[model samples]
Target: MATATRRSSRLSSLAESISSSAGSTQTPNSRKRKQSPVATPSTPPQKRQRPAKLPAATPTPSAVGLMAHATSATKKPTNPMVARLADPQTTNATLLSPETSRVITHMNVAAIPSRLPQPSTTTATLLEEANAHLIKVDERMRPLVENNFCRVFSPEGLAEAIDPFESLASGIISQQVSGAAAKSIKAKFVALFEGDRRFPHPSDVAPLPIERLRTAGLSQRKAEYIKGLAEKFVSGELSAQMLNDARYEEVLRHLIAVRGLGKWSVEMFACFGLKRMDVFSLGDLGVQRGMAAFVGKDVAKLKNKGGKWKYMSEKEMLELSEKFAPYRSLFMWYMWRVEETDISTME
Candidate 1:
């Protein structure tokens, strides 16, 4: 009986060992356990492979340089929406909306300058170049600028004509709209004109039926305003060169004297059309906004209280532009761009 009991105990131990071995070798009974990638969540997931990495972003280049290259390089924009879109690398760059893509492709990204003063370049060397560029942006832009204003200009020459026309146009559109809304609408306008106009000549523009101009996304009044200017140019009432030939103040005075021409409008014509350095139209909201932005504030109530902008009087805006000197027009242009436009302009 004692021998029989020992053999039974030994058999029980052997059975227990066999059961443990079978359980360790076998798969789980559940279907999920059998098929799941990892039986349970023990680690974070790895990202799926992407097709490719995006091109590394470049340091902001000068808008003037970009425009000089882009405008001269192609008759039509490669991507028209890029100018009005937000920066691709910015936190806010990730966005949704039908117009978002359009904004990134249709606008003139070259309109604004991106570079600033760097050790490799100097104020004097860039001054001459900026001065010359200023002359081309607008005639009145010349008056608000100075011949000797090379100091501020060259170091910050890229600021000279950054966003030249688009910025002015943005200011025109942004009177009461949010920056995003203004950009969306502005993209439509740029897409319509730059794409469809095919560099409409002054005469071609003058007689464009109001409907045709409107189709290009301009409001009736704006269309008329542009047409009226065109007609004036075609007729002897106004000559575009008159602004070029006249002194800076004379240019401003003459431009502002036009019935529809205001300080802001004249400033744009000067900054963009003429490429004047050191221009700041106090009447412009974008200038005000840019001023606030430069000072690092979001519409501070004490704007006037701070002496920084105040010290830059109407004349000083020109003089301070001189500190930026010949690059004033570029500065005005880029700052204007910052108000409502972006580098994503498609072309």
Candidate 2:
């Protein structure tokens, strides 16, 4: 009985211990203790960041040069619509949305030299004047005018009136001859001078034998013209300075006064030799044909002969050329570039 009582006391003590352990435990639904979050100093939420913008892409000078040469190698764009579409300025304005244009304008504002004030007044003035004239011509012939003719119209030393006697002589030699043949003949003509170099005067030409001039490939008629031109020059009846000072009419008269110079020759001299800015030549078959082609007209009928054809008449040429006044010489230059189609080439 004593052992039993001791065992029962042990059991009671064990039960009390179990109850104290149960009282210390928490239920799953109870809230967790809020230990102050280990004080990592809070950083203010970063303002929403934006991506960096790229700088405008302007072509380098060398890159632009390469692009220009490559562009030139391709055949010129012929369609007016295509030409307009190819231009960045026109394309952007015509095709892009307003917001896109604004973005492009902002990006390219620094790269565009057109927006910058120009310092060279002379070039700008000349180009502005030429463009004003060309804009009128473009209205009539958009396709031809839009395709590049700047090089054709650009001022070149080919038309400088440095020496009237030499210039006219060169023109005479070049008449009805291929450029290569004319060059060879001119060299021979100059060689004759070194052999007959006694006097440095145009009168000196009088003493040169007709046979000697013919040896340089001049036909009998051309020989006579050269001698007569020299005589006029020696007499001081014609001078480069005088021609430079004279009006177009006076210059034409003075050149015609020479025995061999015809209207075509005189026109060539005025337009190419004297650099007359406004002269136009109706007699130039090339110009007539070019104008006809550009105007989209048949230049000639096959049955015609002796210069009578459906080709643009001299009166029409003059009237049509009026639109390019003051820059007609440049217009004439570009005419030579027009291709001679089968119809245009017919007699």
What value of lDDT does candidate 1 attain over all alpha carbons?
0.39
**Could you say which candidate leads in lDDT?**
2
Angstrom error at residue 116, model 2: 28
Cα lDDT of model 1 by residue, 9-37, tens digit = 23223333344445754322212222334
CA displacement after TM-score superposition, residue 172 of candidate 2 (Å) = 1.8
Candidate that would win on TM-score: 2
Which TM-score value belongs to model 2?
A: 0.54
- In model 2, which runs have C-alpha deviations exceeding 4 angstroms? 1-128, 141-146, 150-161, 195-201, 298-307, 340-347
C-alpha TM-score for every candidate? 0.38, 0.54
